[model samples]
Target: MREIKILAVVVVLTLITYWGVEPFAHSQMHPHVDPANYDFAQADKVSAKEQVDEKKEALEKAEAQAKATGNEKLTHIPKSEYNEAVKFEKTINDFWASNKEALSLTGNATNGATLVQANCTACHSIKKEGFPPVMDDASSAAAYGVVPPDLSTAGKLYSKEYLVGFIKEPTLASKVSHKFVDGRVHPMPSYSWMQPQEIADMVAYLQSIAPDKMTDKEVFQNACQRCHGIKYGDMLGGTMAAHTPETNIKAYMGKVPPDLSQYIRSRGAQYLHEFINDPQKHLESTAMPRVGLTKDSEEKVISYLEKVGDSKKAQREELGPKFLIYLVIFAIFAWLWKASKWRDVH
Candidate 1:
């Protein structure tokens, strides 16, 4: 009886911990829809493309009616809608302008180098010659579809704005390649909960490191393919082994790297760029190391990921709130059940 009570207490406490802490942490740390304003049913009622199509059809019908009736009244979308869109655009532009100025004031490659060492080197590698201190390609490939890329020339490939946006919110960052037609979750975690200024500094460091010229495919093949295999079937004309032996990887890092086949679908370009620039800072004690890639190199790498990985990352992320709400309801019911069952125990 005593043991049963103790077990009950433990179970109840564990559930409470998850209910109270994990969800709260998730809400605070992860990007989620605004609870007060977002309506999932309404959001799903029409996609942007569908909405545009409907408007076009309506306009066509209106034009036909006007032609038959000889009415010349101009048809226009609501001015307020246009004004609201313009206002949002202006707000975003202003936000970037201010951030860019701040970045200029504080950003420098020399300082960025130091910052990279403190925050980035653990999961990312800048040079191709030396092995990373921890996990290597073989083990990484087994886990994430590819080993992290080498970032010797990232700045030349991506724009500074892209770098900044990615650093601010990795999962929300734009993809350089194909758009997601099917909804799928991204694997890269968000680091936006951290200090915004630190993210800016990392972006500056990456910009400073980019080489003058390196194509996206070249960057992926040279830096990424050692851990990640492109499924396009022997791009090297069947001359090289697609993957390194597991034993070769075990000799160094004791694990195979993940495949990056759908990395862009799972982690988006900005997220990948920032993650390559600094993984440990975002996820403490993560097995992955930083690759010391510049903005351009990172961009190219992400473009390749977008080519292969899940395309509907944004839509997938959109479902996070729904999951959280479900968890919250489950937690409440669990608490109520626990209370009822243990009412007479104490």
Candidate 2:
């Protein structure tokens, strides 16, 4: 009976800790956050709807102004703006909806090779194919504010739709449209004049030469090493852009992007996931553009971060079950001993 009482007390305390105290403490410390929505198509729909609504609101305001001031021409400006916004929304929607079919259209890698050499070789390099940038890293950085990435791995690192959109309209594709406004332009000029088939062919040529599989470290290097550095231990040496010099990057970016060495531990995976998906969502007006990594690529990048930042995670997980088992055995022996002692007392 006494043993049962002690066990009951122990269970009660454990239950309280597990169900009440622990959750409360965690709630105060970590606070719940919604999981990131990785569906880009859904996100695009939401953004388009929001943009349409904003234009509608502006049209209403313009109508109100025309009524108050009796200047009918004033309404023309907002009316035109509203119509443009609606058209833009439709275009974006159509692009996203037909993206798969567009990508499925077979491309001519041979023609793609010629097209890329004619158009892209000036600003970009294809190191895998022995095509170097027209200018050295320093000269390119000075001219373009940042050295363009080598197209060797771009085909594997980014999504087909993203590559297409980026080539068509860099500012819009990167989600930095808000910052580059009123005649301000992104460094990469829009290639909207290129035929859709031509763009598809370029993407095909890139994919033809890219490796089938890339390690997590390689993924990070291809996607992020241009703007952010990993300074933990000798990790910086592993980055593809390590030769470009951090000072030039800092100048181009307006500020030196934070070292991502401990970001997984500090920012947590969820925040990083969403932030990478769309930088403007978390930090408004941030210079970091959307990286446009596919779901698989993003997960690989996050996995690499964990490997770097949480090196002991595997060991910790391995030991957890053993420790719990040891405690359970010890508790059983302890209960038996207590019973033996109290058996004589009673």
Candidate 3:
């Protein structure tokens, strides 16, 4: 009976910790957030189609209202809604969907090279083609507030759609619309005026030079090393070095980006996914812009993070059950020992 009482107390404490204390602590520490939608194609398609339809519907409604009121002009339409219709006749997403086919069109890499030389060499570099940035890292950072990434592996790192959208509108493609609002000019100007064939040719030129298969470290370098550094082991000195100095980044960004050495363990995978997809969703008005990595590229980058930050994850998972079994056996032996000691007391 005494043993049963002790066991009951232990169970009650465990239950309280598991059901009450743990939950309360977690709620305080990490508020609930929606899981990441890893399906970018589906999400982007649906969202873009919806926005286009909604805008078209609004414009049609305004026209109908104007017609009913005998006003040939859309004078009755709300100025804000009218402006939205006119300004965003086709969003970046819409443009991407419409122009996706151009990716397959045959293009001249020479022509693409000439076009890039003429327009892009001022700000960006095609290191693979021996085209260095017009300015060094310090000069570039001072001039543009951020060092432009080398386009050597951009074809492998980013999706074709993202490249197209970014070429069309850098602010919208990178999901930094908020930062560029209220007449704020983005550092990279919109190339919406460029012909679709020109955009496709640029993408083809990039794709021709990028490696077909990249290791996780390579993915991290191409996708994330421009801004975030990993200070784990040799990574800081090796693969995870940022292009620009930390001081320059801090001056431009107003804060040094955190070392991502332990971010996998600290923020967890889901938070990292959502945060990377859209920084403003997690931290409003943050300086970090959406990286626009494709699903595969994002996965590779996260996998590399896990490899560095949680190197013993597999070992820990394998040993966890063994430790639990040992604990149960120990508990039983302890109870038996206690019973023997108190055998004569009652």
TM-scores for all candidates: the values are 0.37, 0.73, 0.78
Give lDDT: candidate 3, residue 320. 100
**Cα deviation of 71, candidate 2, in Å:** 22
Local accuracy of candidate 2 as per-residue lDDT tens digits, 1-346: 7667987999999999999999899777755543455556567667667767978999999899999999999889789978877886886677666555546778788998998888988889898999977888778877777778989988888877788778877776777766677986777988878877888898888878888999998898888876777777333434333435567777756687888888999987887998888775667568888888888889989998887788777899999999999999998898889888888887
Worst 10-residue lDDT window for candidate 1 reads 35-44
TM-score of 1: 0.37
Superior by TM-score: candidate 1 or candidate 3: 3
In model 2, which residue pairs have backbone atoms overlapping below 3 Å?
none
Model 1 residue runs over 4 Å out of place are 1-106, 128-133, 143-146, 175-187, 194-196, 215-217, 220-346
All models: lDDT?
A: 0.53, 0.79, 0.76
Best by TM-score: 3
- Against the true structure, candidate 2 reaches a TM-score of 0.73
lDDT of 3 by residue, 35-103 (tens): 454444444455445545766677778778888988757744454555664454455446556666665
lDDT of 1 by residue, 213-242 (tens): 776677777655564465532223322233
Candidate number of the best lDDT: 2
Clash number for candidate 3: 0
Candidate 3 has a TM-score of 0.78
Q: Mark the regions of model 3 whose C-alpha exceeds 4 Å error after superposition.
A: 12-16, 19-110, 234-241
